[model samples]
Structures are given as C-alpha cells and as structure tokens.
Target: MRPLFVIVALSFAPAAYAQEISAVCKYEYTVHDQGQKSGTTGEFSLKATYMLPVGQPLNVQVRTTKAPCYEFLANGDDMQISGTCSRAAQNMKMVYVYKIDRMSGAFEEHFSINDKTGIVHYGHCLPAKPLL
Candidate 1:
C-alpha cells in the first residue's frame, strides 16, 4: 500500500478578512503507479482547503505552511506554493510542493514530495489555453 502520510486534511476558518485567504477544493484521482508497471492501481478522493494571507508569506511552524505564492500574469488562476511541514516534533521533516491552475473557481491540486519521481493527477482538466 502507498504511504498515506502525505495526505493532510486541514481545518480552516472562513476568510478572516477579504485578504485572508481560504478555499476548499475537492479532487478525485487514481493512485499513480510509480513506474512499477506490474502493480495494481487504486484511487483517491480527497477534499483539501488552501489557506493563507493574500500576498503574504505563510509560516506555520506547528504542522505545515505555505512559503509564498505567485501567479501567472496572463491569468491569475495559475499558481504555485513552496513550503515545508514538520511532523513528530523535529524528528521528521518534509518539503511540500503544490501546483494548480484553474480557469474558473474550480481547481485541482497536485502534490508531490521532494520531486516529481511520483505524481498524482487530480481533476486538473481545464479548457485548452494557449501559453503566453
């Protein structure tokens, strides 16, 4: 079975202020086969909320937090956040990466640890868009 520690469910409050960021996005995807063509595949359905202060660096030393965020100039929907979350005190450390681009309010979050060696695709479908 795949390690499930990567899954994090965060409970957040509604926008504390207009610039106080908070959003809940639901994604459904299949468990990716990490280049092992002989293994059986499974699926994952999860709901996660992305939160932070608009245009501010997120530093949550407790569990996990976003570093900072920037979006595509051509369109504001595309974004990426780099961060790190520590577990079991200082014993465990993991760097988290989040990337997503949504045309509308709908969004799909793709997460990977350290690198892209293993990737899972959620409902990341968007209409064909030309690159700038």
Candidate 2:
C-alpha cells in the first residue's frame, strides 16, 4: 500500500506543476520610417488574455491600438483591424497575418516592425510562443 501511494502521488505531482489559465500578457512596439529621411517613429501596445490547459491548445485574444490611429482585435486564429484618424492617400487601416505557438507561460507578447515598410507592429499571443 505504501509503494502504491508513492506512485500515485508522484504522478499527480507533475500535473500540479502545469501552467495555469487566466494568464495576461502585454507587449509594446515602435516603428521608424527611414524612407522619409526625417526619422519618424510610431508606437503601439498590445495585450493578450488566455487560458492554458494540459492536452488542449491555448485559447487567447490579442488587442492592439495606436492612439488616434487604429485599433485591432485578434481572437483565436483570426486577426482584424479598423478605425482611421484621417482620410489620406495611405490606407489608415491594414490587416496583419500571424500565428501563435505554445511556450512556457500561459500568455506571451512581442514587439516588432517591418523593416521595409517601417510599419511598427506589437502584440501578444498565447499560450505564449513555444520557446524552442
């Protein structure tokens, strides 16, 4: 009986160390435009909330916004952006393509920008990107 008890306890111990749900992540990004030859920068922030369950894919929602510019909503595997500050030649709004992988934390975030377009993009995804 003692040996059987030890085996059961050890098996459950590993499960107890798993990541938890209700994880919140935040990320900030800055974009610089070198083409203008004027050195201008744009900034944005992103927040992600999600749950992590063993043997289940992480579920998450990503929200990003650039003050006086645009806001975006990304849920699960879908990404969408809307809102505009002005009606200029350039499209005030644009959609981004991305994917998420499981990592250590329940939630994860990153800041990045397109080198050629000088488009600053920042956001968080979950259940955090895989470390490997």
Best by lDDT: 2
Tell me the tens digit of each residue's lDDT in model 2 across 25-120. Answer: 334443444422223234334444433332334343334453332323233422211212222235343324333322322122222233234343
Q: What is the lDDT of residue 66 in candidate 1?
A: 27
Q: Where is model 1 more than 4 Å wrong at Cα?
A: 1-18, 31-94, 102-132
TM-score of each: 0.31, 0.26
**Model 2: residue 40 alpha-carbon error in angstroms:** 5.6
Report the C-alpha lDDT of model 1 over 14-54, residue by residue, as the tens digit.
Answer: 22222112333334553453633222233222222234343
Top candidate when judged by TM-score against the true structure:
1
After aligning candidate 2 to the native by TM-score, how far in Å is the CA of 20 from where it should be? 11
Cα lDDT, model 2, residue 81:
17
Please list all clashing residue pairs in model 2, or write none if there are none.
none
- Candidate 2: 10-residue stretch with minimal lDDT: 78-87
